[model samples]
Target: MWRAIFRKKLFIAIMTAQFMIFAFDTTTRADDVSIGFLYTIPTLMGFLIIERGLQITIVVLSITLILTGCFFPVPIETDLLVFFANRVLSIITVLITGIMVNYRVRMEQTLGDALAKERKASAMQRAFVSMVSHEFRTPLTIIDGEAYRMGKVKQAVSPEDLQTRVKSIRQAVSRMIVLIERILYTSRAFDNKISMHLERVNLWTLLKSIGRQHSEVALSHQIKVNVHDLPVSIRADRNLVTYILDNLIGNAIKYSPEGSVVEVTGQTNGTMAVIAVRDQGIGIPEADLPNLFEPYYRGGNVAGISGSGVGLYLVETFVRMHGGRILVESVEGQGSVFTVQMPVAGAEPAPAVSTGESSFPDKQ
Candidate 1:
């Protein structure tokens, strides 16, 4: 804010000085010379103005002022040819200076933008490395711990205990596989290498399958699916669609408290198929909403939650590939609802969905 105020003050000062020079040039007559050339000073100074349009306007105004000075009161002894020639020369000088200044400013802006992007990429790379290290270490530790426990047991292990240890090892390995797949998916998404094997898929059947799978893993959370209004079938990439749903549902379960409800609702809107995953979870902070889908960006409030932060990014990417969009609404400490809208197969593109007020009710 202070910088903006300073810029405004500087702009006013430059314009004021330019006008004063114009007034002096118009009022004074010096033999056969033109003082209009002094306008170049202000035209060059226009570099300080951040806006290219305003800078160009300054140049044009300077030319106009120089030309106007020619018709202003001057000595009768002043030669017309010399006066007109000098004014034209002054216009050319100011115009050239303005162009150079504008060009320089543009180059500076481009360089600044490039630098900003570089910085962001660097930061993301560091975060990705750190996250990968931590994510891999957790599963590896679990697998190692289970192995060490079985090896150190002095007595014969019971069948049930052996099964539990084996399950733990498998779960750890499965988690590692998931992490690998997510990383691979993100890479493919960035390279635009993800190919969709479009096929007619049973949407309702897929939802039930996903719900049952999540229910097995998150036994404490009640997973509910309502697809009464949803289209039974749609042409889509089954794998990508599954990825989208899996991520949303998994996140809903993972982020919410044990015993909380995770609801998956589906419906149709015009030419669109809408799916929403709502959860009674530790709601996202309002400030984090805008960056929620940015890769490696986790919510500020999810301190102890285990996450790689790529789930929502992949979700959004897959949805876009299917010609859909995702909308999210959350109130801190209440819950969140993520709505996915996709174009129905064999239909014209659906109209854009407005994310008006959130449907998630405020907690009493």
Candidate 2:
């Protein structure tokens, strides 16, 4: 044990200095160099205890200090108070530094946790989109094959029967393709995966079809869908615009209770397309409106509602990408309204419309 202490740098220096201290007038404890010899070994011991460098270090230092400093006396003044004071100071320093280091380590761990969550969310989005590709590719391949086979059969089959079967097959395949694309787009948008590609599209024609498609739903709901402008085209991605409309119109239908009003109105005011989807259903609470676009965030009245909470988020992202904005208005039990403003190609807010809205559709 004594040998191990002698081998340590602190202990060796202590021994060397002890020899030097005695070489001079050995009675002075306050001589800085002498006090250094007086203080060194105990400080090392304090560090050992606090750093858990003991059981290993103290076993040796314990025996050595007792022997050299107390057991075998050097005919000099050894003040007990000074020795203890130095040890206490060293221990305090070790404890405080240790605590701070631990705190920093904990903070780093927390940061890592947040980063991990974000990464997991991103991976889930990618996986969801990837599945869309795989699933759609298979159905699309079958559709292509069926269409090709039926085309060949056209040469042999009667034309009347052929037309009906072909039309059904084509329509069904088209719907599937559109659904798949919507899923991909919507997922990416909600996942915060945004990089838009902007292009020019006739605003009037786009809203006209969107209005016409939902015409039956509007009539049933007793809602009127109006296209404010007839032939004005806007600079934006047509696919993304379609997705935004789908969510709005679809949501209107979902919550409309079979005979409510839904209005689809649009206009190119100055340099943007102003589109609004208004419906009469169970209105959203004023408090819940803030989090409407948050993923999985549903309102109080929507407790049993069949929605994934990705709609408004996708809408917001798409609108922003087009360097545009969205606004909502609602009163409890009256209904809700959502308006989207998208920038023109060369107008203010040069941002483009990011595609991939069909990312998270109503999961069936």
Candidate 3:
């Protein structure tokens, strides 16, 4: 704010200096057309700093007319038409300068806004890299340790035990793959390369597949799915839908304690499909809920949790791409429910870009 005020004051000072120069020359050298042109300096400067550029131009034009008339009076013996024509030419020049000044100012503003967005995107990219490194390390370490154990205990370990170890390693790899795919998809989305190819998807089968995929993680917890009554099929982008479910369920498992229930439910309401992932986990803080979907934003309760804070952000993005909305309802200790509402096939038109805030239930 202070910087804006300083710029305004500086602009006024520059304009004042230019007007003084014009006034001095008018008295000493009134016949000089260039002396009258000095007023354009202040008029253009006003457009650069002030939003009221048009008003400033009019003020400068009026002042110049008055000062010029005082000094360059039309002699009663001189031809009146010649004097009027000269004055009219000077006024036209001032008007053209004002228009050009305003145009330049608008162009500068457009460039400034684009530069700001570029900077923000750069920051997000840096955060994503750091997060990927941190998240990948844990899974890679688990896989490496298991491989080392298998190498050392070869033949000595029973076939059953060997199978279990291999399975564990595979599960770790699976987790890593999910994370990597999300990163790739998100990158594509950023590049505007993500496209929705809607096809008929069986919700029941999809839910069961997601459950089975995470069976390793579910060994210590329960993923209760209740989608039997849901529409047998819905038109949606299968890959994007999978991404959304993966994040939601994966998060529910990650944040919840061992043996906690992570419930998945689906239903149909009119032309919309409703799906929710409710978890008995460490619930989001009411204060932090509003920024939950913001890129790289983690809640206060997520300390020590292994998360990049990008999962929910990607979930929101994919949901919006389907012309749907995601809503969050949480309590500090009672857990949170993420409810998604998307239109059924051909129910609503999806746009290339969407604008809206994700819904957050009021804190109770």
Report RMSD (Å) for each prediction in the order shown. Answer: 7.2, 15.2, 8.6
Give stretches of model 3 more than 4 Å off.
1-101, 153-155, 208-216, 220-222, 285-291, 294-297, 346-364
Residue pairs with backbone atoms closer than 3 Å in model 1 (clashes): none
TM-score of each: 0.82, 0.50, 0.64
Per model, state how many residue pairs clash: 0, 11, 0
Instruction: Report the lDDT tens digits of candidate 1 across residue range 49-147.
Output: 646666556556655665666667767887776666665665566667767777887789899999999999999999989989989998999999998
TM-score of 3: 0.64
* Candidate 2 residue lDDT tens string, 288-336: 9998876545688876554545567677777776678889899978888
Instruction: Please estimate how well model 1 matches the true structure, expressed as its whole-model Cα lDDT.
Output: 0.79
Report every candidate's CA lDDT: 0.79, 0.61, 0.74
- Candidate 2: residue 210 Cα off by (Å): 0.9
User: Who is ahead in TM-score, 2 or 3?
Assistant: 3
lDDT, residue 55, candidate 3: 53
Q: Rank by lDDT, highest first.
A: 1, 3, 2
- Best candidate according to lDDT: 1
Candidate 3, run of 10 with poorest lDDT:
355-364
Model 2 spans > 4 angstroms off: 1-109, 112-182, 190-197, 229-231, 267-270, 303-305, 346-364
Superposition error at 228 for model 2 (Å): 3.5
